[model samples]
Target: MNDLTKIMVSKGGTPADITVGDALEYRAALQEHHAQSAGHTLFYAWLRRLGSLPDDAPATLRNPSRATGQVGIEQLVDRCDLTCRPVRDLMVDYLTERRPGLDYPNAGQRPRSLS
Candidate 1:
């Protein structure tokens, strides 16, 4: 918490005035320094419990990197490397129609079976 306190004081704000952006910047600094402390998460939670954060503040300070979006049907089918063009198009259409109910792993498996 001393690190966060330093950040807050440097910005001319108290601990209660720390924003989500401030927390993220701190996390980035930790990453840059290859630090592996979970203190930030604890401190963020403490601030939240004291009602120091906005209602829209995230429940956790951990910002996991995830794939931006789902892969397209064409991309999924193309990965299968089906030699038959007509069969590839058919798989694409079939997967596109069924994609609403299927997850990525299941959708990916369907095209591989045809290969």
Candidate 2:
């Protein structure tokens, strides 16, 4: 990232002063605040519109869109594989339920086959 300067501007007879550290923090805080406010606003608005969705509604349907209400999770899974993650979870599970004699790191490494 490039270095940004904090400018002290004279706006409408008022002098605004900010330091370098203040500018970076202000930018990040502003972005995070926007994201949180948007999430809260959208959640309440959608909840007010649609009382409560049934269990059959897919995960993708969590967000309300302009198209249709019947779009389910199967379509989402078909369009995009949401489970394409690293083998960290499988490694954790294996480590949790490992036998003492088995050499997990050097020898047999049994994991959930995603591919």
Q: Per-model C-alpha lDDT, please?
A: 0.74, 0.36
**The best candidate in terms of TM-score:** 1
Model 1, span 14-105: residue lDDT tens: 88888867877878888789988476578788778888888877777674322224567898789899999999999999978777555444
TM-score of 2: 0.17
Span of ten consecutive residues with least summed lDDT in model 2: 1-10
Give the per-residue lDDT digits (tens) of candidate 2, residues 47-92.
2345343343333323334234534334433445446444444544
Q: Give the TM-score of each candidate.
A: 0.52, 0.17
For candidate 2, what is the lDDT?
0.36
The model with the greatest lDDT is 1
